[model samples]
Target: MPLDTEFSVTVMGLGYIGLPTAAVIARTGAMVTGVDVTPAVVETINSGRVHIEEVDLDGLVSGVVARGNLKASLTVAAADVFVIAVPTPFTDAHQPDITFVLDAARAVARVLKTGDTVILESTSPVGTTEKVRDLIAELRPDLTMPGRNRPGEQADIAIAYCPERVLPGRILVELIDNDRVIGGITPRCARKALAFYRRFVRGACVTTTARAAEMTKLTENAFRDVNIAFANELSLVADTLGVDVWEVIRLANRHPRVNILSPGPGVGGHCIAVDPWFLVAADPANTPLIRTAREVNDGKTDHVIARATAMVEAQPPGQPVACLGLAFKANIDDFRESPALKVAQALAERFGPRIHIVEPYATTLPPAIAATGAVLTDIDTALETCAAMVVLVDHDIFRSVPLDERRGKTVLDTRGLWPDQA
Candidate 1:
């Protein structure tokens, strides 16, 4: 059954995923308290505004705040449900770091009540949710905790793992429309968590063990990473043979069984670029393909940087090179694990003031790029002045530039933005 309107929810980490999630849940008439350690984020959401960019999120947050269905805070508050949606960034050595997830769980445990449902929405390695269950068991021994050992037994507080599968621009719709995989430490725990999601989600909510859900999330991303690696590797091979990769893909994809993903500078976003590593790290000996795919995708960035460098170096010494877009993908402001940013930053570090960056979404240059003397200019200035251009991201604004206007400029289009120019 769907949860009642009177049931409350508290979301930890009011970031890209968390904020949208909080606003979406709030729209369902459930009172929501969004928690974040960042003061700016809390203040922004409380002011009926959004800290991050997403389609229609500003109005939704503003409406929910105005309607008194949502509020923001720095500390965790007592609620019928707690959703941990924090980051699970990997370490420098590519190990899965669940520090944020565990921290959020700790905060929830402090204020946890007998009937509260704790759901972890963070994309994590397998066994992360169980760690949350074990941590809660250790912290609050007074309350009974569910586990495989206690199988099917009722627990004071229900705990589950529920990872979101959302595209950047369509998070709000997907958050509700996407089928959810709700995995619990126990079967009863999964049922308890399902009621909360059932209130808003229009799609089916499948139930399973917590470990399976975690692996499912990782598998989904890893599968994409592997496929993207194939596309990226094909792009490299096509370049070696002086063949048009886009043309090759277009012809190949005409076959009924063939469906090749578009190749980019590299794999990116918080999920595809990071989650696959979790699976690889979990068991290195058994994951040769997954590990190599990660390596290939990462290497594609280095390859991009090299080719872009050559393009810039070919220009006259005094002439600047315009490096377009910084976001991981087109039309989005998110730069998390973005290969485009890596390429831009590398090129800027090499040529310094000779690199002019055009990112319509970014107001200020990333510190690394700006510190190296790369100037942030509009597309007009870049087109007018720079003799060489490297298209890192295929943003709509960049794609609209006509072939006639860029006639005299030397172009290296990584994203296949302007086919005529290519």
Candidate 2:
């Protein structure tokens, strides 16, 4: 059943996940306030403009803001429900850093009141949700916390962990349609969060303990990382043996039980590359396979950098070398932890003005690449001029380039988009 009550919602950290979540929840007839530390993000959304790129997001946010169902703020506002969707990036040592999550928790603690539901939607380490619960309990001792409350007693607040499961290109549809695993500090807390999600989610909402839900999100990403590692490792073997990794995988998958993932420059983005390490950090000794998978995936990026550099090196000293695509995945503008970005940055540092980057989605090169004198060019400009090219991302713009246009060019296709040219 849908939630019967009309409740106010406060969505903290309006980035990739939070802003869309805020907009979608606003569609449910709930008053949604999207909060962010950035003044520009607040201003942009308040003016019915989105700073990020996601399909159908700008229109949705615009409509919700115009209809008075949604607004963005620089400060937290009191609401019936609070959603924390901040980035939980790793530290310099690759350890999971929950400082942003903790800061968001403190902010929520200040505004929390009796009966308000606090749900964390960030992908985090196991027990990080418990840490949030503990921090909030300490800050607001006047209110009773679940899991710390006496037996047979009701707590003053509900805290839950529900991770988002959505692809970047299709976040809105998946956000509404995907099943959710709502985990709480207690059974009552889980039920409380489940009721809130039922308001918007078309898919089933299953209840569980907070720790289990946290692990489930990590496990999901880690499992994919492991599969990708196998493909990446196979690609390396094929490269060494002068064989087409794509054709090899295609043939191997003819067997009933074989299903191999495609290889890329390396794993990137906020989830698959980052979440597995959290599990490894929790118990390093027993997580050799997970740890090794991470190593192999990271190594693939270095491999791409080295091989792409060699390709450019083979060309004349002053010849332009085009590096295609920068986004982590195809058809999206997001470049968080992108291997393509890493490759471009390294090549730019080495070749300077000789490197030309062609990312159809990016209007301007990232500052780091731009500072290195790597010019951002269109596909036509890259193909007409550059002597050597490396396909880092399989964006449609790069895929549609015909063979005749690429005839004389030296090409290294990491994404296997042009298996013939590769």
Candidate 3:
């Protein structure tokens, strides 16, 4: 039976995942109340604008706000559906620190009512949904579980874990287009969740037990973490052996069966680098592959820093160096845990006033980044006068940069963005 009622949904957290999810639910004609701990985020979403960058998110949010289907608040209220999309970062020793999830869950529990369905949409460790169920049960002992069509005797709250797997840049398309994994504490719980998502989801709905679904999400990221580590490790070997890793991968991938991952400065952003440790923290002895992969990817930051430092040391006396790109990857302005940004910081620390940074996407240098004495300059000015230009990010703007005039200047291409002469 499809639950066709107008769902009054409250989405907790307003970052990358939550805001989009809230907007999409509102697009389905359901009334959505988005809650964020940060007051600024609440204000931003309420204004029909977004603080984060995503394709069409601004328009989607604006439309929802204009339609009066979506609103933002600082705390949760009673609702039919509650989605917890908070952060689950790892601790210093690489253990899963789900404090945010726990706090959000407790807050949601405060407003839970009869027949309410609580979905844990944050990427979490296995058994997290069940743990949430237990927490709710402990908090509200009078409510009964939805079983045997009984709906229990008291106020009932159904709990499920539906992991979101969508690309940050293409969240809107993937939200409806990508198949979803829905797992609940009970079969009734699972069915109810599937029915709720079917309203907007164009892709398949994979039903499973809650723990399996949680592990499924963690496994997806672990898979990426491991493959990226293989590529990063290969980069170290290729550098030592004086081989072009990109060329080797290009040839190797020609077999069709062999697919080598691209090596970069380091893994960045929230997903790939952070999710694997959740598994490692849960069962330390059993996840050697996942743990090592995290170490490899995390260590790559230092390797990139060392390479740039060597360039700084080897530069001609008093010749200014230009750093191209600060973001982790090309075409995006996100600098969270960016290896290129770290490299620039390290270079400025070692070279002092000699380093000039060029990040075309960044309108202004962040305070933490600006203190390093890396002046943000335009692309032309950087390429024309700088003695050494180290290409850290493969931004397309740097592709058209005239290296002919830079024949005598040092060009250390860490990104391998330029073509080689025959």
How many residue pairs clash (N, CA or C atoms closer than 3 angstroms) in each of the candidate models, in the order given? 0, 0, 0
Off by over 4 Å in 2: 1-5
lDDT of 3: 0.83
For residues 8-101, write the lDDT of model 1, one tens digit per residue: 9999999899999999998888889999999998999999999788899999999999999999999999999999999999999999999999
Best by lDDT: 2
lDDT by residue (tens digit), candidate 2, 140-252: 99999999999888899999999999999899999999999999999999999999898889999999999999999999999999999999999999999999999999999
**Cα-based RMSD of candidate 3:** 2.8
Full-model lDDT for every candidate: 0.92, 0.94, 0.83
Cα error, candidate 3, residue 142 (Å): 3.0
Error of 1 at 43 (Å): 0.7
Steric clash pairs (candidate 3) = none
The lDDT-based order of candidates, best leading, equals 2, 1, 3
Model 2: residue 142 alpha-carbon error in angstroms: 0.5
